[model samples]
Target: MLGAFVDGELPASARETLEARLADDPRAAARVAAWRAQKAALRALCEGARVSGEDAAPDAGQAGAEPAVLILRPSGSWWWRAGMAAAWVAVGAGLAVAATMLVPRLAPGLAPELMAGAAPTAARSETSEAFARRADIAYAVYSPEQRHPVEVGAADEAHLVAWLSRRLGKPLSVPSLAEYGYTLVGGRLLPGNTGPAAQFMYENDAGERLTLYVASSAVDRDPVRLLRDGNRRTFYWSTERTGYALSGPQTEPKLREIALDVCGALGGKPGQW
Candidate 1:
């Protein structure tokens, strides 16, 4: 139940009930916090699949080390099973296999560059940086696709927004980019650091593409900033704990203009971000 709540998979009514309970019982809230941290650490290990030498996995042949090789038991779903297998295959006997033991030592003991990127209470700066990087990666991976770039097409805009809104636990508005020569191609659901994220893709007649990545966050309103990652450029900001990043191959000035437009179209106040 706590995991479901943290994931925003619980119904709103049940979530309210849980929140009330958590408010009355500090232990419940603590449990939720710890669960979210564990989820984040696991996600990091799976994505990075590497451990710093000092925090490396316990030796397999060392005495008393066998017990530390924790295997993730999947919860009887095809997706879970596949994820488990992928993590195992990716890390072998490395980070993914040892994240359970590795996470506890993360907070003040390791560098921020490690697999455990940040603590649960890390500043909005960290979150915004990660959000932009993820957006850059997402654009590089999916924007080049000639087929199936998005799970839902623009024709079903209502359904796409509704579906992504449910997953992110926040209502979303799909901004029109037609004025800028880019039309909404579609959008897709994505995995976020803490929960779920959504990405909306747009394309121009010249086949150039841009993507907007959005996710629920816990951040103060941050002004838009540009991040250049290789050939991709991203303009990212956060308002009321919701992070947004617009990424593409366009010129910095052009992309910045479009990002500001998206921020405005989504009802973000000019001073808010």
Candidate 2:
């Protein structure tokens, strides 16, 4: 009966069979919990990590040494009898495997590299730097000469905040940059596999432009970092509480200075921005 449960083939008959066996044996319950936890750990590891089916099974002699070793070997009479019931259990286990997977795909944490990448890129990495760069490029191509800054304009600041906040899963505010000699032209909503995204445009007196790309963190498991790539300098860093990526074209020192001011205004320490 315990073997049937471990094989994930426990059907009504198996349950009836196991009920009698388990009723007299306390170890059966412990085994079931252990197997469940084992399934859970396997599912969690699979969230973003790739694996081959061959490596999915637990080693035989290692069984019960750790609950994670109780690999569900779905076969034989057990699965045949239970069918989809076992499938539903597997799905429930999968959901428990990772709450981050349940977040809206557009809401951030889309790519693992930004989170797992080396150092600062990893630290300040939100969902995807590629997406951030793509977003910046898209804005650069489309927003100049008032070609079209946004689907929504500054007049709709309320809608802008709510819509972007919903997509990013983080509170967002368009920092008033008028003090920095820039005025908000407007903002645009963008597509992201991890979640909805937003870009706020600010232009100075000389027509110099800067866009703030905001999104949710892909992982909160690490520190913040600053990344410089191509023609852009990004002050990417994360707080123990959250993550942020600020990228622009200025020199590293200038970008760093701006990042410091922005971080200060955003209630984060300047050293991190």
Tell me, by lDDT, which candidate is best: 1
Q: Which ten residues in a row have the lowest lDDT in candidate 2?
A: 63-72
Superposed Cα RMSD, model 2: 22.2
Per-prediction TM-score, please? Answer: 0.55, 0.46
Quality of model 1 by C-alpha lDDT? 0.82
Angstrom error of the Cα, residue 114, model 2: value is: 25
Each model's lDDT: 0.82, 0.62
Per-residue lDDT tens digits for candidate 1, residues 7-29, read: 77898899999998998776678
lDDT of 2 by residue, 1-273 (tens): 576676556787867877777676665677887987786676555543333453444443453422223335556776676987888899988886565555435446544533454454454444545544555565455446465656677788889888888777777877777776878777777765355667777778887776776655554433334565577666654443344556666687776766667666665666532
Question: Residue 60's C-alpha lDDT in candidate 1?
Answer: 36
Per-candidate Cα RMSD to the true structure, in Å, reads 20.2, 22.2
Q: Give the number of colliding residue pairs in candidate 1.
A: 0
lDDT of 1 at 226: 93
Off by over 4 Å in 1: 1-126, 271-273
